[model samples]
Target chain A: MKEGNFCCHKTTERSEKEYKSLMNRLSRIEGQIRGIKGMVERNVYCTDILIQVAAVNAALNSFNKELLAEHIRNCVVRDIREGKDETIEELVVILQKLMK
Target chain B: MKEGNFCCHKTTERSEKEYKSLMNRLSRIEGQIRGIKGMVERNVYCTDILIQVAAVNAALNSFNKELLAEHIRNCVVRDIREGKDETIEELVVILQKLMK
Candidate 1:
């Protein structure tokens, strides 16, 4: 592949709507995180804090899953169609790491 | 702060050298991944494959650590300096998720 083509595949572009949605989710998560910090500072119970932490974790994981799914559908699939076997391996490694 | 300033801190810019170095490491990992696939196709021992998987995981984690460190130093620090407490919460959440 041409260097430019390779470069293009190296990064994914998000539409404005997609970007706004992601930022909105991130901002909401940010608020939850601050709440957690306030809980920490106010001597909240460990179990309660842990529960909130778990929720935050689940939220972030959900976000990451969506991003990874988009990556696979866009970048990985494009690379495969363009005859880039290396990207397949790259993606496999990425997925295994994410799973871990 | 102006919206442009906020936008600037929202993304981190990497130097060419840094970008090249990351891509090099990624490429090496990619090759290792292909090797793993070949091993799988040839019916390599499960333990052996698992070991390689662990190595790849470690490498990827290391890469992520470096990137996150840079992010904290550049984007997060700048945001904090600019009086964006929200970014602090964002980063704390990000770090907590990364740790998991």
Candidate 2:
């Protein structure tokens, strides 16, 4: 884990390509974000802004869901395999938070 | 993101030490988590298990709050300074989810 990096697991040898693809998606999303800011600065209609806001929200939630899927497949499953049942509790706690 | 790593930002040159410290705390919490699982496997009192579960929840929440604070200070603030108001909407959406 690095200061700005919230990832707890070390990068796997095979995930570099996937990581790059995810970053590309995030970059495009980042640009769309800038477009929204421009719209706000131009005094765009509140309803229009709100619509864009909703789109962004959906996009972000999708991204988070994908990341969470990966986390469960990789981290949580590995813990279970290693007989680390306690990690299940950690995951349950995380799930509870996410559900909230 | 690298498979299991959820961090979106590149590590700064300065946060290595802080990251290590955070990981150490996480390791301790992880051990406590295993203890909870052992209690469960032993068919310990349900009330005792629930108490431990609550403690784990609080501990995890505190950890997440600290991480979120760091994220806001680093990622959100940087986006704002770079004229990215749309990032505010992203954060607002995230906060709404967290509050839920």
Candidate 3:
């Protein structure tokens, strides 16, 4: 990690492709939320809106899962190999939070 | 249900307060998402971003639960009272999706 790019608290430098993918996922999720807001505003059927909400939730979950996998593969693995055992505890804590 | 406001498929007219409350919840969720996107752009730590994503997921779940409660209390119950039994099926299907 660079000066401004700490592994955990500081930051992580993602490849351009990684950055783009994460941003794209977030952008799509954001747009979905906006669309749901529009549905609510237009007084759409409750079930219809609920179904859309489920879709957004799924998209968010997908984003979380993908990011978590990458984090484990890169950051967690590198930290462990470097004998940064605290990273394991940090990973455990976040896993608990994400599960909740 | 009014002409343009069918109970399920057509639409359901929500009270002004109901509308406002739902919109407020959605707006907050939308803002939370935007904040997450900012974190990604700033190259925040992966675990940190994952935690924020979890929070957003919880917020979305809260919104879904609230909306579902209102739908049951109003639309589902009313339809049942009116002998429109199909509403029950619709409710069941949406519940399955939400849980999924």
Candidate 4:
């Protein structure tokens, strides 16, 4: 909600802890990308770089799991309880995307 | 080492479990990305989409951590024990990149 921390749209306000957690993960990922770039720049064996690439991909999956769980727990469930049936439809569409 | 699973360079051979694990994570990420794309297609709320975007980013970080740990255990450490000092330098550059 703050000026500089507009990491997400204002549809839902994340708790301070949630926002920090998300930011922390992103910062680490930025570092990882820089590391990958460095490997390429330095020509550290091609296979070596590939290994890191695979690792980064896996990290991404874990991230999705964490936030998706949080979304279901905090946002979607509450919206549905408050009689927002459209949110359920929206969630279903999202699940379809994830399962694809 | 197989023909179809050229997920990484031939620098290291992942065990069956490791390879499967990496592949599984990637498959899930592919699904997650597709889900995000679906949100865009449906014209979902911007904030909702942003939350998912943030989630994907975090997942990527986790993927990197898993693969990195495995790389150190199987590749870098082994290379060092086998008297390849260059690998140490390579790993240090990698570490510096990650810590950046």
Candidate 5:
């Protein structure tokens, strides 16, 4: 696969609306990270930049929550219904890592 | 201030090493965000992307901790020694926000 074209071994084909929403969220986060970089470059107050960083963290958390919910609602539920019980263990492991 | 040249009303001139260190961390984070965006664009598995997002969150947390410690060690300490006790309140407020 080409560099940026590399897909996961397993992929989830998100709906158009879901894909757009996720992309928009990520674009905003990318812009925020760039803004924080500019603040650092300009020697901004530590607490000020720190506040921006906190906001980015919140954004990332929200994104994760959204994606995780979709995963549970679609992927895990579908797998369990198909008798793929191993997905439960996978979900548990990832949840442990996420909650850490 | 010019478009990308805006500086904070109050600033702290970090040491050369400190400046480079902070910039490096932010650069890595910015790259990580871009990588995540690419992963999303490539329709990577939800769990894999979530794992990457968790790593980014941990990176951001480390960056905040490093900057906060420097602020406390230098800015807060200096302000207190100079009888500018209001820095304490400012520190307290930002800490509250961070903890939230």
Candidate 6:
């Protein structure tokens, strides 16, 4: 799939490059998930399907890391620079939720 | 915004209704984030922007909850019933990460 499709589909919190990368990764993950579903439906070996599932989990984590980096650099940093310390508190809340 | 746009735009793990609901909620959240960005750019009152940001956060949480419910009901259950115990481990790992 082409990158940046989500640019029209989501908010503009990331740079075009970041946005493209994110959409690209998400697209691949989406495909990976579909593939896993096919494996399940086709009665692939349990261990093999499990391994694919693990890979999907890893892919999701990598996506999260990229998103967090973009959020910090673009949203959090900008808000702090503009004297919106409230963004810090918001970030703190999300971090708590994520770490929970 | 019309619902189910993402059904075409992404992989389909959801029923039509679920896909619609999820897509609708996400589109609204996308718009909400954009609105918050506008507030930020215009130097809206800090507290007000923060409030909207909080709303966005809540929306996101709602989305997550719905998606998680669907995952447990659909993916996890199906996998387990099919004798794929490994899906349980995958769920445990994600829950741990989310709770972290």
Q: Which candidate is the best by DockQ?
A: 3
Q: Write model 1 residue lDDT over B1-100, tens digit each, in one string.
A: 2223435323335566655655565565555556655554454433344456557556555555655666677767877999988777776766676666
Cα deviation at A32, candidate 4, in Å, is 15
Please give the distance, in angstroms, between residue B97's alpha carbon in candidate 4 and its true position after superposition.
2.5
CA lDDT of each prediction against the hidden true structure: 0.56, 0.53, 0.88, 0.62, 0.90, 0.58
Error of 5 at A98 (Å): 1.2
> Per-residue CA lDDT of candidate 3, range B1-100, in tens?
2225444455778999989999998899999999988998898889889988898899889989989999999999999999999999999988888776
Candidate 1, DockQ to 2 decimals?
Answer: 0.02
- Give the 10-residue window scoring lowest on summed lDDT in candidate 2 chain B: B1-10
Please say which candidate is ahead in DockQ: 1 or 3.
3
Q: Would you list the clashing residue pairs of candidate 1?
A: none
Error at A79, model 2, angstroms: 37
TM-score of chain A of each: 0.85, 0.78, 0.89, 0.83, 0.91, 0.82
**Highest lDDT among the candidates is held by which one?**
5
lDDT of 5 by residue, A1-100 (tens): 3212575277888989999999899899989999988888878889899999999999999999999999999999998998878789989999999998
* Residue range with the least summed lDDT across 10 consecutive positions in model 4 chain B: B1-10
Report how closely model 5 matches the true complex, as a DockQ value: 0.74
- As for DockQ, the candidate ahead, 2 or 4, is 4
**Which ranking of candidates, highest TM-score first?**
5, 3, 4, 6, 1, 2
TM-score attained by model 6: 0.47
Each model's total of backbone clashes: 0, 4, 2, 15, 0, 4
Which is better, 2 or 5, measured by DockQ?
Answer: 5
DockQ of candidate model 2: 0.02
Please provide, for model 6 over A1-100, each residue's C-alpha lDDT reduced to its tens digit, 9 standing for 90 to 100. Answer: 2213544321334456755675576566556656654553443433444455456556655755666666777767877998878779877876665443
Tens-digit lDDT track for model 2 on A18-95?
455444544554555566445534434333444554554455455446555665787668769988687678768766
Best of the two (4, 5) by DockQ: 5
Residue B100, candidate 3: alpha-carbon lDDT: 63
**Interface RMSD per candidate:** 16.2, 16.5, 1.4, 9.4, 1.5, 10.3
